[model samples]
Target: MTKTFTENDVLKYFYNEVSKLEKEKIEDFLSCNNALTEFYCELLTTEELLEGKLEKPTEKTIQNILDYSNTLCLQN
Candidate 1:
């Protein structure tokens, strides 16, 4: 038996981890469910914003890891 998509599927869908059939079901449900449609729209908007908002690591952090690795290699 196939499982129908529910509001909970929204999170998996947003993460692009839903199966193709499940995605189709989710789309179908969103088309007819007004509350779900609004929620889906908001989720899509948030995903878009998050995609381009990655934070860069500081140079000191990178140097610290490299220094630690060098010390471990010397001890070994």
Candidate 2:
């Protein structure tokens, strides 16, 4: 049986979450379909941008989390 792929499947392909067979099928499908290929490209660009923009929480944010945990522990 032939399986049809969706955007979700393409995202799985992007993250290497799909099985080897599914990955091969998705790549073949993307090669044939311009629109789906474009969507996949967009996902790639968005992922790269997100990776580039990653940042750790501020010290204040970490302290706030610890303070909240302490309050919860006191209440317990």
Clashes of each: 0, 0
Model 1 stretches with alpha carbons more than 4 Å out: 1-4, 58-76
For residue 23, model 2's alpha carbon misses the true position, in angstroms, by 0.5
For model 2, residues 25-70, the per-residue Cα lDDT tens digits are 9999998988889999999889888998877889999999999999
lDDT of 1 by residue, 1-76 (tens): 5455666787788778888987888877778789878888898898899989999999999999999999999999
Q: Give TM per candidate.
A: 0.60, 0.68
Off by over 4 Å in 2: 57-76
Error of 1 at 3 (Å): 6.5
Computed on alpha carbons, the lDDT of every model, listed in order, comes to 0.84, 0.91
